[model samples]
Target: MIRFETAGESHGEALIALISGLPAGIPVDFEFVNRELWRRQQGYGRGGRMKIETDKVHILSGVRHGKTIGSPIAIQIPNRDWKNWEEKLPVEAGDPAKHQAVASPRPGHADLPGALKYNFKDARYVLERASARESTSRVAAGAFAKLLLRALGIEVASHVIRVGHVELERAATWDEIVAVTEKQDVLLSCVDAETEARMKEEVEEVARTGDTVGGVFEVVVHNLPPGVGTYANWDERLDGLLAWAVMSLQAVKGVEIGRGVTAAESFGSQVHDAIHYGPETAEKPTRFTRHQNNAGGIEGGISNGEDIVVRGYLKPISTLRRPLESVRFDTREATAASYERSDLCVVPAAGVAAEAMVAFIIAQQVLEKFGGDSLDELKRNYDGYIQQIRNF
Candidate 1:
């Protein structure tokens, strides 16, 4: 099975990731992997931490000369800010006076519950691991998955669609999304400039109020082959897997596939895609086609040869500039929640994380459908499957 895990604290020395079950002889692209990390650190409302950390991955194992050897891949991303934090958070015990203690837990954060779970008097221990910085390793792993998927003609990308009630009125085209996301200079990461401007205004307004804002983003997967996921098992459903992946991101409160939520209100005829048969060409035979993609490139838990569209809804960052009411863990006295340096909004960055997650899931599914010990072997299996699909 394709599996991966990430380890490290928010302000720890470095983040580590281990990914396994990939075929050998697949090329690893270092620049693209680092670029994915860079994309996650971007966005208009990011905090000072983004200014401190420039995430870049170092692959330590599972590849020889930039290609996988079909073994587990291990990577590390150093925390540049660890220098300033070394005295406070050393691996070896340091001075008690140097320790940074968080007694008051933020209301919406994982501080209180996590502290209670671990019996930690200081919420710092909880908040450190709970921080969204953990996603850095995820983005790194996803970048690797992206390289794998790219080899098979699949591409994943994401862009913001709404921010704090400032929603894009219409869906953006594939070209528009690629044009905006690929650019080095991006603000809200929205394809519609005017909508992004309004989103900026919304962020500015929220900033003035010492509050945070949430928003929605869409991840699009292109050139995916049909019949990858199965209807035989509920746990193997593509929609379920996609939703779970996107929802796992920090601050992401909701997830949807295609017109998932809207379909609930519409008639069955309006919600479903209409199918048609296409004429065979010189390079291909007769094929099934759909005029609309309201199903979001999936039907009955399987991909139907359309672009897979998934949307994630992120809640506002829990750490407020103006603290909320909370009781101190030690004192048990009510007070303003402790203020932590946090983003005014993170929808754009969250979108990038969501893209990574989607890519990883699709890559996992692709591997599961076309398993092999080497790239050439996997490609042969994949090509044969495509031929079978086209002929069917």
Candidate 2:
């Protein structure tokens, strides 16, 4: 099975991503991978960390002459900020005086629970791993997954739908969503300029009040074939897997598939899409069509030949500037929560991370369904499946 794992702390020497089970002959695009990393650092309300780091992937193995060789892939992204923290966070035992302890835990952060579980006196270690900076490695790895999906004529993109009380007035079209990625500067990543401006105002207000804001983002997977997932087993359900993947992101409190949240309040007729049949075309390999996509391109745990839409409801960044009420980790005395250098908002960045996760999950499903040791073999298998669906 195709899988990936990430290592290294937020302020460590570097972040590492190890991906395995990729077919041979898949081209490696360094620029595209680095661009994914760069996209993760954009958006309003980002903190000083983005300024200190310029993320670029360094391939260590499993690729030669710009192509995969049917082996494990190892990727590394050096942390420029590590230079300043090298002495404070050395691997070997160093001077105790150099240790910077998080005397008090930040509210809503992993500091308290992580320390309690690991028997740590300081929450610094927890802070290092729990930070959203870890998502950089995920984005890098997801970029590779995107490359695989792209070769199969599938594309993934995301956009901000809401920021605080300001939300997109209408559903974003596929072209509009894809256009957001081509812009030179990304402001909140909303498709509508007027709505994004409102989001900016909300962020500005929060920054002035020393508070943070959160919002929702939608990830759209286009040109995905039907039957990528199976309903034979509960764990193999596509919707459940997609929900779990998106919910795994830091600060994301909820996951919604299509109109799932609102569907609970609506009638069945209003929630379900009507089906129709049309002649098979190059763009749509299958003859089946839907009047609407309220099902989010998924029904009964499998893709249903429409764009898959997933929304992530992200909470505000946990580390605050003004801080909140809390107690010292060692002493029980009540005090203000510890303050840290953090963002005022990160919904746009979170959307980018979610896109990567969705891409990885879909790629995983694709590989499981169309097994091959080489790119050509995989395409042949995939093409056969497409023909089978078209003839159905």
Candidate 3:
């Protein structure tokens, strides 16, 4: 079984990840992993933390000279801001006077509940790890997952779809997305120029008022062969796995596959993708086809030889300079919620994180479908599955 876990606090020396169950002999690209980490720290409305940390992955184990040996892969991303925090958050016992304390819970953050659950008198402990800074490590682990998927000809990418009140009307093309995303330099990382400009303006407005905003992003997986997910088992549904991962991201409230909630309002005819088949081509062994794709490339919990599209809806950041009215858990006195250094909007960055999660889940699903102790064995199994389908 493929599994992964992360460790370390937000202000600690670094974050760590352990990913297991990948087949051996897959090439590992350090630069690609680093690039993903770099992409996660970007966006027009990022806060001081982004300016403080330049993410880079340190691969300590699980590969030999950049190829997987099949052992659990481990990665570490050092907290650049740890220099300033070392004294306050020292690993050893101290008077606790030097540490950053969070007495007030941010309105939308996990602060209050987490504190209550863990019996923490203050929320500082909870927010330190709960902070989106933790996603940096997940993105690192996902970078490796993407590398493995790419080896099998699977490709994943994401872009901002909507920012606050502004939404882009058209879907971006592969070439258009690749041309710019390969560089990963733009702040909004949006394909529509005007929409991106408007998003930046909105961020400026939010920042001016010390408020936060939210938006939506879509992650797409292309060039995936059919039968990579299972319909026989509910647990093996790829969409379920992908949704869980996306929803785990901070501020993400809803996840959609293909048409999503819109399907509920539509008649069956409008919601379902009809099929037609014929005219076999070199690229298509079972006759080139696809009358519609409203199902979003999946049927009965398995891929249908079409691209997978999943969009995530993110709510505004919880931390606000202009605090909301609330009472302290201990005193029960009316007061403004505590404010923390935060972003005005992070949908662009969230897009990158969503892609990481999508890629990781898809890669895991692929592994589950085609098992092997080695990359060559994995490829053999995959080829056999395809041949069986073609001959059927």
Candidate 4:
């Protein structure tokens, strides 16, 4: 089975990503992987951390001559700010005076619970691992997943749909979503300039108030053929897997598949997509078409030959500059929450992370259905499946 894991703390020397079970002969694109890391750092309301770090992946194993060799892959992204933290966060026991302690737990962060669980007097260690900075490694791994999906003619992208009260007025077309990634600068990752401007205003207001804001982003997976996921088992459901993956990201409080949230409040006729048959094409191998995609390209836990839509509802960053009411971790007495250098908004960044997770999940499903040890073998298997569907 295809799987990945990430290691390293937020302010550690570096973050590492390990991926296994990918077919051999998949080309490794250094520029594309670094670009994914770069994209994660963009967006309005980012904090000083983004300024301190320039994330770039250094491959350590499982790749040679720019191609995978059918073994586990290890990727490392050095933290540029590690120089400043080397003394404070040394691996070996160092001078206690050099250590910075998080005396109080932040109200909405993992600080208190993590400390309580691990018997830590300081929440600093908890903060290091739970920080969104870990997503950098995920984006790197997701970049590799994207490479695999790309070889199959599938693409994944995400865009901001709402920031505070300002929401995109219309549904973004696939082309518009793809265009957002090609821009020199990404402002909220929204498809509409006017809406993104409104989002910027929201961020500016939050900054002045010493507060933060959160919003929603939608991930679209295009050119995915039907029958990628199975309904034979409840756990193998595609929507369930997508929801679990997206919700695993930090700050993502909710996950929505297609119009799932709205369908709950609407009539069945208004929510369900109508089907029609048409000429078979490279894009639509089955020659089946849908009148609308309100079902979100999934029905009965399987892909139905339409673009898959998944939305993530991100909560505000837990660490606040103004801080919140809390008790000291050591004393258990009343105190203001620990203040940290944090962003005023990170919905756009969260969206990028969600895209990575969504890509990884879809890639896993693709591999599960079309297992192969090499790229050529996988494509041949996938092509044969497409022909089978076309015949059906």
Candidate 5:
């Protein structure tokens, strides 16, 4: 029963993440984890918050001497921006006049509805928790999951497939995804140089217009063993879980597995991947192969020894530089929506977040199938399952 939960506000003192159910003896990689956090803050069109915050995880509990001890792991990422807001949002009650309040709500944000539900006078409280800043904690958790999957010969990577009107027509190879995503300098993490250039132009146009742009990103998981997810229950299905995880990201409006949405418009024969037999080798007495991956490495709610392809569609940043029309909470008079410091585009960042989410889901499924209280015990069970399948 692997699980995790996150707490803290967008501008709170620190973001907190608690993850449980990991077996003992899984070594923690601080460098890799920090690098993942760095990746989340990259990409063009990011706001000033990225410049202010250099996210670094501080382990609070659950491990000692750099290895898990079979307990819940806790991590904290301090908010550098909290310093400026401390007086305005102190834990202890302060002067009402000193606290910042938002009388106007952003049109596309959670401000209005959240304020109404909480019976608040304004949107300040709602915006604090609803901000995408919370994903920072999720990225930290996902980094651990990536480490777990790496030990099992599985890898996860992601890239932007579209930005505004610019889109990649061809599917990216595993090598291409790794190459582009790993690059320190990229135009929104797009694999194609020409396409990425166009995406940059599209971003520039939106920035000039004081508007925002949305696009799609694809996450790929490679070398994952088959039969990781179950078909017995709808909640246990890998596709459903993956979809839900990706959709949980802020501003992500849609999710797709393999060629999911496309398959609906095409005939069954054109959509499904055909099975083929391959020559046996010493390590494997029998082999199965698929020339196409339209099914995205999953079929009947289980991994099928192919690359798991998931795509997330992100809407434009809800907080616009040029505000939209809205009514003021107090005045009830029509006016421009309250403006918040926001990005002109965030699809590339969303892709990175999606990668973390997908990795977390796969990690949970792996633990569920290969249950163990220690890394060594889990490995032995996993190896036995692989051997059983190889000889089938």
Candidate 6:
């Protein structure tokens, strides 16, 4: 199975990620991975961290001369901010009284529970790893997965669906969606011109008021092959994996597949996709296609050669400037929670993270369906599956 792990702290020397189980011979792109990392730090209302750091990836190993060698890949992204924090978070233990800083507990964050569970008096332990800064490694690893999927003609993209109280003016079409996303500047990543403008206004409003606002974002994957996942086993379900991935985003409160909540209120006729077949043609004939994509490119836990649509709802950043009222961990005295520099709105950034996670899930599913020790073997297996589907 294809899997990955990332280790490091928010303000440590560097963040490291290890990804394995990729078939050999798959060519990887370093520039694309670095670009994705850079995208994650963008959007309006981002805190001072973005100004301090320009994220760039260093590929340690796993491939030679641009192609995968069928081994685990390792990547590192240094924290430029670490220079200042070296004494605070030293490689070796430092003076506790002078350097150690504790927070009573921040409302709407992992601070309290994590500190209590780990027996840490300080909330720093919770915020360090819990910070969305960790998504940097994910972006690095997931961008590689996206390259693999792209080689197989699968494409994934995401956009902000909401920001603060403003929803999008309308859902975007495939071509229009690509055009908007291709723009170099990604303020909010919202496709709707009018709504994104309104959202940006709201973000500015919130920042001036020292408040934060949360919103939602959506991702879509197109041109996926059918039968990549299985319905036979509950654990083999593709939708479950996608949901798990989307929900794993930091501050993500919910996930939606296809029509999602809309399906609950509608009749079966409206929810189910209608399939059609036609005569075989020389160019693209006999290949079954769908009139609708209500299942989000999945049926019975497997891909159905359609577009996969996933959505995520991100909560407000927990480390608010206007902190919430809470009791101090040591004295039990009522006071405001510790303050931290945080984004006023992160829907656009969350969309970036969502895209990475979605790509990772799809990569894992593809590897499971077509097991190969090398990329050439994997490609052969994939071609065979396509031929088999055409024959069917």
Candidate lDDT scores, in order, read 0.90, 0.93, 0.84, 0.92, 0.90, 0.84
lDDT of 3: 0.84
lDDT digits (tens) for residues 1-392 of candidate 3: 66789998888999999999988999987788888888888888888888888899888889897799999988888998889889888889865788777767777788989998999887888998999888888898888889888887788988888888888888777666665567646678788888888888888888888788999998888878777677888877877878899999989999999888789999998988877777655564344357767777788888888778889999999888788887676787888888777788889789888988898888888887888988899889887887776775
Local distance difference test, candidate 5: 0.90
- Residue-level lDDT of model 1, residues 231-260, one tens digit each, is 989999999999999999999999999999
- Cα lDDT of candidate 1 equals 0.90
Per-residue CA lDDT of candidate 2, range 214-266, in tens? 99999999999999898999999999999999999999999999999999999
Off by over 4 Å in 4: none
Error of 3 at 383 (Å): 1.9
Error of 6 at 285 (Å): 8.4
Clashes of 4: 0
Whose lDDT is higher: candidate 1's or candidate 2's?
Answer: 2
Model 2 residue runs over 4 Å out of place are none
Q: What is the clash count for each candidate, in the order shown?
A: 0, 0, 0, 0, 0, 3
Candidate 4 per-residue lDDT, tens place, 1-392, comes to 78999999998999999999989999989999899999999999999999999999999999999999989999999998999999999999998999989999997789989999999999999999999999999999999999999999999999999999899989999999999987778889999999899999999998998889999999999999999888899999999999999999998999999998989999998998888988867668888899889988899999998999999999888887788899987678998899878998999888889989999999999999999999999999999998899899
Q: How many backbone clashes does candidate 5 have?
A: 0
For model 1, state the Cα shift of residue 153 in Å.
Answer: 0.2
Candidate 5 vs. true structure, TM-score: 0.98
- Model 3: residue 142 alpha-carbon error in angstroms: 0.6
Could you tell which candidate, 2 or 6, scores higher by TM-score? 2
lDDT digits (tens) for residues 41-75 of candidate 5: 88889989899999999998988999889899999
